[model samples]
Target: MVAWYDPGVLAKTGLKSLLSETIGRQADRRLLDAVARPQPLAFDYSEDGDGKAREELWLDYVSDLGDGWDSTYAVASAVMAPTLEVRDATGQVHHTEGGDVLVFGGDEVYPTASVEEYQARTVVPYEDALNDRRHRPHLFAVPGNHDWYDGLVSFTRLFCQGRRSRGWQTRQQRSYFALKLPHGWWLLGTDMQLESDLDASQVEFFRKVAAQMGSDDRVILCNAEPAWIKQQVKPHAGRGFLDNNIDFLEQRILGKRVSVFLAGDLHHYRRHENTEGRQKIVAGGGGAFLHPTHLPRVDTRPDGFVLKECFPSQKTSRELTWRNLLFPAINPWFAAFMGFVYALLGWGVAANLNEGAVSAPPLREVLSAALQSTGSLLVAAGTLLGAIAFADDRRGKAWQKVSGGVHGAAHLVVALLLTWGVSSVAAPLASELQWSLRRDFLSGLLLFGGGALVGPLVVGVYLLLSLNVFSCHPNEAFSSLAIPDWKNFLRLHFDKDGELTVYPVGLRRVPRRWQHGHSPEEPVWVPDPRDHRATPPALIEPPVVIGRSKAPPLTLGTGQLAPALVTQDEQPPAGPV
Candidate 1:
C-alpha cells in the first residue's frame, strides 16, 4: 500500500513539489509583488435596525477548509450558521444575524493548489454554505503554501478578481488586505508566501499604512502558519527569523502593536496568550485530519514567556525522522536493491523446488513484478541522485550535511523495518503452502512493497502538517495516521470602545458516516471549555483565554491610504481581536 510508484502516492509527491516550484518561487511573485500595489479593499460600515441591530463590524474566520470533504465543510458552515447575540463595540449584547465579513486566514484549498482545486474545494462549498446561509458575508482570503502551489495565479483569480466570490464579493484587491474595522482595530492580512519575507510591495504598502497608526490604534494579524511550534523543537525558533519578522511587522510596519495573532495551519485548536496579553490562536480545525497538540516531551516556555495553548489536546506524530526528507532519491534505490536480491533468493527456491511446475509459475510472476519494479526504480533513483549531486551546494550550510546524513539513515531504517514487519506477518500467513517457492515469493513481494511505502507515508505526513498539504489538519483519533477530528472555526465580535472578542465553535464530534455519506448532518456546535476536551498533553494549559491589558498604547502617526480600498471618510477598526 505504501508503494511510492502508485498514482495516488505520486500525486502526493507532486503536491509537495508544486508548493516550492510554483507561486512564490516563480516570476509570478516578482510581477505580482512588485507591480501590484494595494487596492481599495476596505468596506464601509452602516447602521440598520434599532432592536437586534446596532450597526457594528463582526468577522467570521475559518482556515484550512480547502479539503474536498463534505462533512467537515458542513461543520464549518454550522460554526457560522446560528445567529448569536454578540456584544457590540458599544458593549451592548444584541442578536447579530449573518456576518459582516468573512476571513480565511490562509490555505483555501489542497492537492497542488490550483484554481480548479479552489473552485471545487472552496468556492463551491462556500456557495453551498451561502445557499444555506441566514445572511451573506463578504468573503476574503490570504494564500497559504497550498494556495501558492500554483504561484498565486489561482489565488489572485479568486480573491483579487474584483474581490468577489460566488455572488459574494469584497473590494479586497490584493492577496493581502489592510481592512478598516470599527473602533481603532486593523486587520492586516499579508500573503506570507512561505513566510520568506515581506515582499517589496507588501513592505511599501504596509509602511504607508503603518505611518497612519494613531496612539490608540491596535491590530489583528492573520498569519498563515504556526511557525512557533516548529521553534519548540529547534530552539533557533526558525532561528528567530519568523519571530523577528512578526516583531518587525507589528512594531515597524504596523506601528500599532499586535493585540491578536491568528493562524490556522495546524488544523486544531491551539491558543497561546503570551505574558504580554497578546493572543496567539491556532484554529485550523476546519476539516482534514487533525494534528497532535503535544509531543513526547513537555515544552517549557522561557522566563517571562507565559504561553498557553487551547484545549482538545493530544500528542503529535513523532514517527517521522527528518532523514526521510533527504533520502527521496535513495528510497527507491534501496527498495529495488532489496527486491532484486530477495528475488534471487526466490529464484533459487524455484530452481531447487521440491514441489512441481505449478508452484514455479507463481514464483516466476512474483519475481517478474519485482524485476519490473527495478527498471522504474533505477530510473527514479538515478534521476534523483543526479539532481542531488548537482544540487547547488554553494550554500553548503552545516544543517544540510547533518540533515542529509539523518535522511540517509532514516530511509534505510524505515525500509528495513517495513521489510521485517511485513516478512514476519506474511511468513506465517503463507506457511501452509507446502514450503513452495510461490509462498516465499509472495511473502517477499509484500515485504518489499511495505518497505517501499513507509518512507513516503512518514515523510508525506510531516509535510502535510508542516507545509499544510491538502489544506487538511491532523486527526485527533489517528493524528497524521488516520481519521478526522471535530470541525472548528473562530467568530470575532468588534465593538465601539476598541475591544475585540473571539468565540470558538466546534462540533461535538466528527460524524461517523461523514466520509461515505452524501451530505452529512451539520453537527451541533458548542462553545469552548465545554465543546471539547483534549488528552493530557496539550499545546498549552488555558487554550481559550480572555484578554487583559499589558501596557499602554503607543503614540503613532496617521497613515495615508491608497485611493482604492478606503473611502474618503474611512476610519480604522478598533482594538485587538
Candidate 2:
C-alpha cells in the first residue's frame, strides 16, 4: 500500500510542543516579527493605480501589528508543511504557533481523494499526530484535484463540516470560508476553480469584502494553486485573471496597502521576495511527495525570488530534534537490493539448467518447481515497487523500470530452464510408452510416431510461450495448452563488445540504434527496413573492397573476425578465377 502524511498537519498537532513551549513568549514574538515586519515605504509603492496602493497599505498595516492584536482571524490557505522548528535572526529555535491559521493547500488527498481514500492516505497519519495533541492548529482547506475525485460534495462534507450536516449550504462548506483571527488578521479561503469559468458569486463576494476592509487591516488570499506565482514565473497565454488576481488587488483594491500573498501547491517551500513590489510566499512542502529535483536546463535568468528555511529556536525551546527517518519508509537502496536478489535467482536457475543432473525427482519437475517459485516471488516484488512508483510518479520511473526489467528477465530465464529439462526427459518417457504398446503392432506404431512428434512439439510450444511469442488467451479450445513457463525459453545474448547482440527466444527484433560490434573496425549487418517492419537500421560494416578483386568470405566469431585469404597483390581472388 502507498503511504503519505501532511507535515503541516503533524506540526499543528503539537509534535513540536517541546520546542514550542521552550521558545517561550519572547521567541514567539520574534518569529512573528520576522514573518510580519512592515515593508519599507519605497518597497510598498504599487505600479498600478489607487486600488494597488490601498492593497499594499492594508498589507503594511497588518505587518505592523503585534500577534496579540488579532482576534477571530482566519488564515485559510493550503499546502503548509512546516518543518519541526523555525529559527529567528538570533539562531533561536521557535516552534510554529499551533494557534495560527492552518490552510490545506489543495491536493489534501493525492492521486485521487475519496472519503475512504483520504481516510487511508491522509487522515490516518494526520489523526495519529492529532491524537497526541501534537497538532491543534485551526485547519481551513481548499480542495485540489484529488479532493474532487469523488466529487467536491464529499470533500466539503467531511472537511468543511460534519457529514451529519448534509445540504446545499454545507456542500459548499469547505470550498469557501472567512476566518477572523485574534488581533484582526482576516483570512479568506476559496476553492480552486479548475473549470474554465469562475463562480460569479464567489468573485462578487471577494470584491465586496475587500472594498469594506480598511487600509490598516490585513487580508491574506488563500487558494490551493498559486495563480499569481504561475503568472509571474510561468505565464499562460490569454489566462489573465488567473494571474491578474494579485494585480487586481493591488490596482483595484488596496493600492500599496496589502501585506503578504501566501499559497501552497508546488510541494516545496519557497519564500519569494516581491522586493520589486509585493510579497509572495509559497509554503507547499507539507508531508506530500517532494517536487522534482531536476531544474530547467536553460535557467539563464534568475528565478526572480529567494528562499528561506525556518525552524524553531533551539536556545529558547528545549531543542526538540525529531528523527523522521521512518517517514518516507522506502529508499532507493531497497530497490537496488531487490534487483540484486532477482539477478541471483536468475544466475541460480541458469547454473542448475547447465549442470543437467537429476537425483530424486525428474530434472524437469524440479526445474519447473524452482522456476515457478522464483517467478512468483519476482511478481510480488514488482507489485510492491509499482505501488511505490505510483505514489510519486516522477521519481518512481527508475524504480519501476528496474523492478519490471528484473521480473521480465526472471520469467524468461525460468521458462527456458524448464523447457530444457522437459525436452531432455521427453525422449526417455516416450520410449517407455512405446515399449508398453508393442503387443498391438498398429497401436505400437501409432504410439511411437505420436511420441516422437509430440515430444518436440511440446518443447517448441514451451519455448514459444516462454519468450512471449505466443499469446496466452482465455476461454478457447487451446487454453489448457497455454504455456505459463514460456519466459524460460528466451535467451538474452550479449556480444563480446558488451552490446546485446541477440534475443533467441520469442521476439528476434533488435532494439533501435544498437549494433553487433564494439568498435567501428568490426563487420556489422544492417537490416533493410523494407524487408521487416520491426527491423532497426544497422551499423556501418568495415570496408570489404579487394582493390578491383572480389573480397573473400569473412570468418566471424563472437568478438573477432578473421581476414580472408589473399593473393600476392594482397587482393582476394575474383569468383575463384
Candidate 3:
C-alpha cells in the first residue's frame, strides 16, 4: 500500500521546514554575529584549477573507501527521490525517515535537471520528508546525469560552500562534506564527477583508504552511475574520475575490503552481486517514471534475485535480483487477428474480380451500395461515440476543454468521411483498373485499407451492444460466459461519459441461471455482440429481483420501486431490530 500525495506540495513544504530548522537558524545566528564580525568572501574555483587536475582528484576520492565502519557507526547516504527505502538485516528503517548520510542521486529533476528543474523536481516532497525526520543526517551527493546536464559548477558551489566562503575546505559548503562517523564509518562525497579522469595520486589515496579497513568492517562506495556494472558490459567506454580511480583500487589496492556499491541512475531498483562477490544495489525508483524491466532469458541466469517485499511507501525490496522491466513493443494477438480478417476480405475481392465470373451486375451493384451505406453509418456512429468518450467534465481550464472537443470532433469527421468515400469509390476504381494491375495487388490493398478504417468502429459498436445486452438482464451466470471471438468480432465502444465498453464475439443467448448466488461449474455459451452481421433484439426487459421470502424479495426497474428498501421521508427511521 503506497502512500499517495501531491509530490510538488509535499516537496515545497518539506524544503521550507528543513531550511527553517537547519540553514535558516544558522543564517540567523550568522546575521547577528555579522554585526560584530565581517563576513568572508565566497570563492569560485572553476577557473583556478586545470581540468586534468580536477579530474584526477575526483577519481582518487571515489576509489578509496577508508577503513570499515566503526562498531558504533553507520554511514548514511541520501539518494534523491529513492522511491524505495532501505532496511537493515533486522528490518530497521534506515532511509526515508532519516539516515546517517544523504546521497543525492541524479535526475533530481525529471526529464531534465535545470534551475527550474530543481524547484520542480527535488525541492518538494523530498524537502518535506527531510524536515519531518528527527535526525539531521550529514549530506553528501554525487552528480546524476541530469545534475551534470548544466555542468557541476552550480551543484558544487551550492553544497560545498561554508558560511558563503570559498576555498577547497572552507569554500565548500557543509552540506557536501565527507564525515568520519563514530564507529570508524568514513563517508566520502563526489559531486557528479563523471567527466573527469583519475590520476595516480588519487589512486594512491584510495589504496591508503582501503588498507585501513578490517575483515569485520566494510567499505561502502557511492555514486550516481553503476560504473562497475557498466564496465562489465561495456569496457570500452572511458572511465570517469570515479571509474578510473575505482579501476586502480579494484586491481591494485583493495582486494575484498569494499562490500557494497550503491547507485541510482537507471530509474529502476536492481541488486546484483557482481563476479567479485560484492552487493551492487541500484535504488532509482524515486518518484520518477518507471523504467522498462528486463525479463530473465535463457542466456541470462536467475542470479538469485527475487522480489522480497513492498512497503507502504511504494518502495519495493528484492533479494539480490537483477531485473529490468521492458515496455511492451507490440501486441501479437492484435496483429494476427487483423491479418486473418484481411486475408478473408482479400479472397472475396479476388473472387469478385475473376474474368469468368457469372454476370450478376444487379447483385454486385446492390452489394457495393450496401457496403457504402454501412460504412457511412459506422463512420458517423464512431465519430459520435469518440466525441462523447473524449469529453471532459472538470471545469475551469477552458482552453483544455475546448481543445479536447475540437480534437474529438476532428477525428470523428475524418473517420466518417473517410469511410464513406473509400467504400463508395474503392470498388469502381478497382473495376476500372482491374486490367492495369495484378488482381492480387488491387484486392490486397482494398482489404488492408478497409480493415484499417473499420477496425475501431467495429470494436466500438460491438462494445456498446454488448453492454446494453448485459445490462438488460444481469445475473451471475452471464458473468461466467466467456466472450467468444472477442479479438476478431468486437468493436471498441465508448459511452457519453468516456467510459469504455467491450463486446466479445459469439456472446448471443444467455445461459440458464444457476442456483441462487451459485456460479455454474462449466463454461456458458455467449455471443459477441461485436459481430456487425448479427442482429440483436430491439427491446430488452429490465432486471428483476429474486431473493428468499424470509429475506424479503426486491424488484428492480426504471425510476423508483421497492419502497420498503427506500428510506422513509416523513418519519425517522426505526432503530435496527
What C-alpha lDDT values do all the predictions have?
0.52, 0.34, 0.33
Candidate 3 similarity to native, TM-score: 0.36
Estimate the overall C-alpha local distance difference test score of candidate 2.
0.34
Worst 10 residues of 2 by lDDT: 64-73
lDDT of 1 by residue, 425-515 (tens): 4544556655565445665576455544554444443334332322111231132232345556777777654467676655435433222
Which whole-number lDDT from 0 to 100 does residue 300 have in model 1?
41
Model 3: residue 78 alpha-carbon error in angstroms: 12
In the range 1-577, model 2's lDDT, one tens digit per residue, is 1221222432332333333334432242222322343211111212224433221111100110000100000011011112223332354543322222344546665444456655654544333223322333345566654455444545655665523211011212436555433222345666544431234344444556666554445545556665544443333222533323333333333343344455555533333343433345444433343322112211222434443221111121111111122211222223233334334333334334324443223555545645566664564466446434322112245534553454444434543344344434444454566754322332223333332333223322332232222211111111112111101000111122222111111111222222333332221222233544332111111111111112122222121111121226534334321
The order of the candidates by lDDT, greatest first, is 1, 2, 3
TM-score of 2: 0.38
lDDT of 3 by residue, 404-428 (tens): 4554455444333433333444455
Q: lDDT of model 3 at residue 291? A: 28
Instruction: Quote the lDDT for 321 in model 2.
Output: 11
